[model samples]
Structure formats: structure tokens, C-alpha cells
Target: MSDGGDEGDDAESDDASAGTTHALRPLRTDLAPVVEAVEATGADAFVAVGDRFDDDLRYLTRFSGPDRPYALVVVPDGASGDDRENGADVGRAVCCAPALFDEQARREFVAGARARGDGEDDDPGDGEDPGDETNAHDGVAREVRTENVGDHAGERAAAAVAELVDGSDTDHTLLVPSSVPHDAAVYLERAGNELSSTDAVTAARARKTDAELDRLRRAQRATAAGMARAETVLADGEAGEDEAGRPVLRWEGAPLTTERLRREVNAALAARGVRDAGNTVIGAGPSAADLHYVGDEPVRPGETVLLDISPRGPDGYYGDMTRTFVVDGDGGWERRAYVAVESARETALAEVEPGVPAKTVHGEAAAELAAYGFDPNAGEGETGFTHGTGHGVGVSLHESPSLTGAGELRPGHVVTVEPGVYGPDVGGVRLEDLVVVTDDGYEILAEYPFGIVPEKRG
Candidate 1:
């Protein structure tokens, strides 16, 4: 188990009166990294379409709403007519959203643009003075321009992109991130701009900033509280009998069904202002043997219940964690499986750090599970350690630098080290924790106990 130490304070920010309000700090998106990534791909510009649902768009522009109503283009800045000649590495991001959200986007854009260490009224005196570098290329918000595309969001966005491509003296090819919708990609292609994968953007997002890490930590704390509530329910659960006189677990004198447990867990998360992104798995017994199973049977004593919750915080970041428990403290095969899973989890976590291959971490966990007398590489139909070791978590539940033991781990990267062993006869045991990759080591963000059974509440 990792140390549950205080990482820092929770991040909270004022909303810009849009469809959704972010309680976390403004996204500190530096275009320099994106520009460099795009430049390396030999593309003159990079475009991201869709609304906040697309994490890439939200990460860069924070434009989220029920309706996807925006497209963003990043280009290099240059003097009036000869921008291509300037060939500056810095980028100027232009956001095109529907007029409906124009005012809100404007407010958000300006607020995010404020330079650090400078007051709101800090000015460079006169325009001719060139001494004020605050408006320099590094300032993402100031260099950003938002345009309103009357009604047709995608078509208008394509038109705006066409204009940008035609105006630029450089290559008209624009790189679109994988998250962009097919229709949006078609629009860009039809507009005469060639499109390619925005792999670099994905790589850039894998590394979180200080502010992003803070939001993730806060989200995980809320998740841990929700987990604690689940534990309390389990701890208070009494041994009982179902209609067939079979053994079961009951809470508050009611039989605890998987659906009931799911509702309660979601309610707990909701109480903390977190929205259930729908992947809240509360599986029991045989159903628990199958990964991603949405259990519906009544939870029974002496059986393991796997709880995996990935909730979206008010700030749009996600907190992913999982824990397996046996109600009423059954000390049989379930507990043994839990211990093995925890060992594998710790082993994998120790391998997390900068410059290490992500697959190496997964391999370590698999090895630990194998040493525990379980098969880490069972056949397709067999029950063993199933699924990947872990995955990167951020605005999207599963992002980049996957922990299949392949990608290179880097500082700012946040991932879960979840290891599990599932079987039809013994059920399953899985544990997960969110952690941030550090320069020298890793820090656990999900600050909660790793016990399989919950202590009785006072």
C-alpha cells in the first residue's frame, strides 16, 4: 500500500455562466507544447472539434455544453501579413463556437488568459513600447480569438477553418485529434485541408500540469469518501436470508441488491458534487468473475463484491478507483484473493515513475500475481488475471500512456495500478488507486485505506 499523505489543497474556480460550471481552477493549457507537437508532425495547424464531451477540446479550450458547438484552430503568430515568414514556435489559438455560448466562452477565455504574477490592471503603458512582454506568445488567453458561427456549428467551423488555411502562407494541412467526430473531419477534408492523427496532442495530454494534478487529487478525495460510504454500508450489513432461504447481506433490514449498492454509491458521490460517468461497477459472486459486469443479483455474505467507480468531478476531471470486499467478513478464498490483488497492486505502483515503460509496470504486477499462485496469462476462456494492468486517467477516464506495460511513463502522468484475479469458482478480487507520476517517484492521490473489510462505525 502507498502512503496516504496530504498532496495539497483542493482546486476550485468560478464558472463562466455556461451550460456547465467548473469548480476547479481554469485549465492552464500552454499552446507552446501543442504547437511543438503539431510542428513536429509537419502540420501548419491543429484543429479540435466537438464540445466539452471531447476531452481534448475541453482541455485546450474548456468549451463544454450539452450541445457540441465549437471548433478550435492553432496557428503560429506573425506580423500582419507575413506570419509564415516569422516562423515563430509559439502558437495563436482561435476558438470558433456557436453565438449562443459566445459571451460565456469570451468570459472564460479572458479569465484564463490572465498572466501569472501580474495584476489585472498591469499594463505596458503605450502600444509602441514593445517592453511589455506579458502579451507575448506564451500567454495563451491573450493570443486566443473566439468567433461565433451563427447556426451551423460544424459547417461554419469548416468554413472558418477553410479561411484560416487559405489565409496562411504555410501548409494548409491541419492535424485533427482522434477525438474529433467523423463528420467534423469530413468537413475539414472537404474544405481542402488534409487531416492526420493528433498523436502528439495525445502525448502532450498524458503529462498533467500542477493545476491539473490538483484537480485530480481533489476528485480522488471525493471518490475515497464515496468508497468509505460503501464500506460503512458493507460493515453495517447484517447476515440474512433471501426468498429461497439462501444466505445474503442486508443493510438497514433490506436485502442489498447490486442495483441498490450502485444507487447508494452514486448517491454518495453525488453528495460530494460528483457526477457518475456511468462506469460504476458493483458486481458480486459469479458476475464478478466477468470484467465490466453490471451485477444484478442480491449480494450475499461470504461473497466478494467488486466496486469500481469513475466519477467526473465538477471541474471535468475524472477519479477512477476500485475495491473488492466480502460482506460480513468472510475469511475464505475471497480474502486470499484480495491479499494477492493488493500485493500485485503495490508491486505495479512501485514501478511507476518518469522514463519507465508503461508495459514494464504491468509486467511487474502480472509477475506478482503469478508468484501468488494465480495465472497472470490465462487463455481467452480461462479465468485468471484478466484485463490490462491499468490506464491513464484525466479529463477522460482512460487517456494515454496506457499501462499495458508499453508506453513511456512521464512526470505529470496520472494512472491507476489496478490488478485483479477473477475465476468462476472463487469470484474475483480487484483493487485500484489513482496516482500521479513524479520526476523521481509516484504519489498516490486516492487517500483511503486498502482493507478488504470495513470497520464498524461508532
Candidate 2:
């Protein structure tokens, strides 16, 4: 095989800057409580059904590649989900897209079947009868998969389960996804008996094992470098087109397209040596107010741009951070909005910690807005400010230990602290940083770039 890495022709990878290692913390093996609960139900095997959740899938399979079409994770009891660390990977495994289940209870039913089929009964004469259907704790093995019954996103998941796990005994409990679509819930009501859902499995996945922490750290380093490059691009005043059909830009080379910037950002990160995280939002002016504005319009002179980037750590631990900059010489509204967002961002970051309520953290941000002449509950500002403070960032882009009004911030949770304001005529400004809840306070995971500035000559 081509004699290893070929020493003499050492190509200039130049990507040494793309950070290595990750930040997965430790895997929280606390699902024993839930496992015990299911076991208490006399279910032999616990089936795991799911939505298109990455963490949920990783809960069973340390899934690395993204190209499977109809994947279903099957695990045996006295195995994972029951014991931590070493229970034997003694379960059947597969990864495919056309998964089972359109809803939860149906998924529960599927679990019943999968667990039964996956149990010791595989010996055929292992002293376990195949037709006895009335035992819950006797010999029921728990299993999980996905299903959908309606036309909505999870309908197919619900349907997939309903089709496979119909008419099982009441002792055979099947789990339904609590995040199931409202329409799908209506259909899951037909399980002949009652059904239930478990809280987010992220809690089961968040506390990363030593290996996961390494992947997350690597992702953050890559993100910080990407941010640095973007700052350079903005400072150089790269421009192209504006909404009013005006051509007012000078590119690094060819015409500057939003698509080009996104592509460049990913390519730059890959060159640095990390798995490309994906696109970044290079929103200008009013577009920044949209929150998730994908960079579609070209950069225009004198516009406010919010550069928000999130790259998933290897093993899928995610990090999110944002900053605001002016493309060209900006106006008054831009300055005020930018400053307000910056102030809010700092205050929010300062308040994150172990015991603080997530709602309290949000209130701290609102207090800053009120000081800036905007109502805390008044919603979007007339001048520019809009949106909530921030959200959790970990295994999933948005997960637990959230900072929303309804959330209760806890230790081990990582979240974004962002605040911004937007103006159509001018642009918008937002400053965001990913912070981890620590024993005392919080840990900011982003490197600060120079403050936002107006356009400067290249």
C-alpha cells in the first residue's frame, strides 16, 4: 500500500493550525435509574427507538460515518443501557435510513419484538417458550427503533414501529419519543394500552468519556481558527452585491458570493486538518436579525455582518460562537445595536455557572436590554435588538442544561451566551461565545477577536 506516508515528497499540509484532539469531557453513565425503572416493569429487553437524533443514535452505536440508509440499533439486556462500561456489545447492530417507527408507543411495540428476538431464546431450545405472551418481568427483553405514522417528519418513524410491533402483550412496554410530533402522538394513542416517553437521552450522552472530550476540544480549536480567518476577510472589505441590485464590492479574487465565503470557510478549516464542520452564516444588516440567516446575499459596503460559526467536535460534540463586524464604514444605528449586543453578551457569559437557574441567566440578559432602553418582555426592539439570550450547545447544537426561560442551568452543561440587535438600513451586531458550566463560574471556549470595525482598505 504505497509504502506509508512517503517521506521525501512531504507536501506542505500547512493545516497544522487546524487543532487536534477533542473536548468530550466524560460519558455520564447515569442511565441506570432509567434502566432500573424499565427493568422494574418486568421487561426483559429494553428497546431503544429514536427520532433522527444524532446523540440518540450514538447512545448505542458510536456511529462515525454519515452514509447509512436504514440503520436500526439492537442491543441485548445485561448489555448496554443496563450496565455501564462493560456489559458486552452483545447486541445486533445496523445503520440504515429507512428506520422503523412513526411514533413512540409503536416504537415501544417494536422494542418488545426486537428484545424478544434478541434474547436467549435465540438458542430455540433454551427453555424459553416463544408463544407465552403474558409475562412482563418474566422474560420480556426490551428493544428500540424508530417509527412514524403521519406525513410529518416523525410520521414514518411512528408508522415503522406500528407496523412491526402491533398487538404485543401489555407486559411488553414500548417506548415512544417524547419529542414526537403532535400529529404522530395522536396516532400513537392506539397502542391498545397506555404508553410513555423518556426524557432526552443526551443526558446519557453528554458527560463524555475521556475520548469524547478530546474530539470536542479539537473542534473548538478549529472553530477559533476559522473565526480568525473570517475576521481577516471582513477586515479586508470583501464585497459583491446588495439587495437593492447595486454592485458595490471588491473580492479577494473573483466575485464574492455568500456561497463562496461559506465554501472558503469550510475549506480553510479542512486545510487546517479538522473534519470540515460545515457552513457559516455571513449575515449582512437585516439578515442578521433572522437569527439563522444563511449567507445568501453578497457583502455590500457599510453593512453590519454577524459571523456565527458552529463546528461539531469529532464524535459530534458541538461548539457554537459568534461575533459581529462592519463590512464597510457603518452608520449610527449599527454602532448602538452592536454595542448593546456586545454588552449583553458579556453579562450573559458572566452569569453562567453550576447552580444558577437557566431562567435567571436569561433574565440577566434582559436586564441589560432594559438598561439599553428596550423592554425585557417587550420582545424585539424597534431599533434592532431581537431574540433570546442563548441556548445549550453540546452533543446536539441545542440540548439540555439550557438557558431558556424555562430551563434550569446545571453543572456540566455548555451553552451559548449571545445577544444582538439589527437595523435594516444599517446592519446588525451580535457577540456570542460558548461557555461551559463550571464548579464556580463558566469557561469561555472562544478566543476574542479585535472588536468590530468599519471597512478598511486592504
Candidate with the greatest lDDT versus the true structure: 1
Model 2 CA deviation exceeding 4 Å by range: 1-16, 19-33, 37-45, 50-54, 65-170, 179-194, 200-202, 205-211, 238-247, 253-257, 273-279, 375-384, 454-458
Task: Assess every candidate by TM-score.
Answer: 0.85, 0.67
lDDT agreement with native, every candidate: 0.71, 0.52
TM-score, candidate number 2: 0.67
lDDT of 2 by residue, 1-458 (tens): 11111131111222235443322333322234344544455433223433435456544433333332223322224445444343333322222233332233222222223323454333222344322222322233333333322243233333434343442333324443354345445434442324456553545544444444455555665676666666666666555655566865556665455566566566756755555455477776567665677757666666666777787655567757677776555456677666676677767766776667787777788788778865456445344456767776666777665566564566566677777666555566777766666567766554455466733211
Which candidate gets the maximum TM-score versus the true structure? 1
Residue-wise C-alpha lDDT for candidate 1, range 84-147, written one tens digit per residue: 3454335566677565665556545434454544543343222232212234325332323344
